[model samples]
Target: MFKFTLKRFGYMLLTLFIASSITFMLIHAMPGDPLAVAARKLPEQIKANYYAKYGLNKPLLTQYGLFVKNAVKGDLGQSLASPGRDITETIMKHAPISARIGGQGLILGVTIGILLGIVAAFKRGKWPDYLVMFIAIVGISVPSFVVASLLQFFFTVKLTWLPTTGWGEFKHTILPTIALSLSPIATYARYMRANCLDVIGQDYIITAKAKGVSNVSLVFKHVIRNAILPAITLLGPQVAGIFTGSFVVESIFSIPGLGQYFVSAITDRDYTMIMGQSIFVSALFIVALFLVDIIYGLVDPRIRVSSGKR
Candidate 1:
């Protein structure tokens, strides 16, 4: 287990490095200057001073090196769009909002999804199963942005049951949370249903049933325990995706989250903001995957053994 964990940690570091490097190169390669729009009316001397201050006048390789060095020291530099605003500070201020919404969405979605799947599997071929499957299909097919729009129209505009947009009270979060959760709900339901069906059909399950094991005991002790493993594998990536916030969802709902800033940064050519956000999200995703790998080993020791051997 120790060896497996160490190996995964090393891989995480390597992946983060590669991701940051790619982000830096790609942002630099993009057309238009980060300061061009804002500084266009300035004198040549002032423009030169501005470029020098931000190290935009430096060569790409030098800037990349400085970025890596500063990032290592926990300094992500300033936002080009909002001059003098520290990128790291911006993240610190906004990340909690995104986390709150994402966390609620993930918990609500996964819990409902797992329950729906279990019911469907237990009532295979019945109306319950059909209904669950139908919900899953529709949820999966519809994009979160579209879901957000419909939710806004129905709940806020038409029904007046929820606020249209903003971030303050609990009511503000409900619509966005639901929008974010639908796809995850759909995803987990399918995975859980499939895994549950497979587990139910196993010879061990059949033998236990033949011995007249209580349905509740059989499900808790045998069915869910074994069936939930695959879902655990999916949890890491799902958490990363949701926790980082959805670009379109944040935009549509006008939530002040890191995702919203990220979108605007792209259009405004805020190089540091873009790089900072990309690195932060990539690191989060890598760390989540690392934790999942460790969890996978703990849940199934055979995985640790196999991984260690390799």
Candidate 2:
């Protein structure tokens, strides 16, 4: 287990390095003078001074070196978009909001998806199964931004049940969370339903049922416990996707989260802020995957054998 963990960590570092490198190269490759793109608020003399101060006049290698050096020291440099706040500070401020929103969405998504799947599987060919599948198909078809906008229009504007934008209160979180959760819930439901069907049909399940085990206990113990493992196995990637992909939902809802900042940084050509966010996101995604791999080993015995060989 320890050896496997070490190997996974190594892979994580490699993944982060690749992601960071891509972020660096892509930002540098964009057409335009970064400082000019950042906007020339100062006079020519002041601009020259700014260039001299920040070494903006230097070659791309020198700038990349400086950026990497500061990054290694946990200094994300200044945010051109936000003059007073540093890039790291801005990201830190925004991360928790995204995290909270994503966390709630993940829980809601997983729970609803799993329940709907279970019901569908239990009923097999009944109307309940068909209805749930139809809903899942609709969810999978709709884009998140469209869903978010429609939700805001109907739930917020027409009904006034929830806020259209901002993260001011509990109600404000509802629309965004639902929007973020919709696709994942639909996907997970399909996966869970399939797994549940297989487990129920297994010989072990028949034995348990023949022995007169209680229905609730049998579902929980023999059926779901075994069946849901596959669904649980996919959870790590799904969670990572949730937090990272919430950018669209956050933007649509006007939520002040890291996703919003990340998008803004790219659009504004705020290299430092963009790089910092990229690094943070890469690191977070790797860590989530690492933790998930470890959990997979703990829960699924087959993974242990494969991991050992690797």
lDDT of each: 0.89, 0.83
Candidate 1: which pairs clash?
Answer: none
TM-score of each: 0.95, 0.89
Worst 10 residues of 1 by lDDT: 239-248
- The TM-score leader among the candidates is 1
The segments of candidate 1 whose C-alpha lies over 4 angstroms from its true place after superposition are 243-245
- Winning candidate number (lDDT): 1
Expressed as tens digits, the lDDT of each residue in 1-310 for candidate 2 is 7887788889888888788878888987888876784437788888887776666788978887888788888887887666667888877788888888788888898899999999999999999999889979988999988998999899978999887887778888888888888887898889889999999999989999899999999988788878888887677677677668789898888888888777777788777788888888778877888888887777777886787875
Instruction: Give the per-residue lDDT of model 1 (tens digit) for 1-310.
Output: 7888899999999999999999899989998788988899999999999999899999999999999999999999998888889999998999888888887888888999999899999999999999999999999899988999999999988999998989899999999989989988888888899999999999999999999999999999999988988898888888788755476888888888888788888888888998998898888888888898998888889999988877
How much lDDT does candidate 2 score? 0.83
Global Cα RMSD, each model:
1.5, 2.4
Query: In candidate 2, where is summed lDDT lowest over 10 consecutive residues?
Result: 32-41
Q: How well does candidate 2 match the true structure, expressed as C-alpha RMSD?
A: 2.4
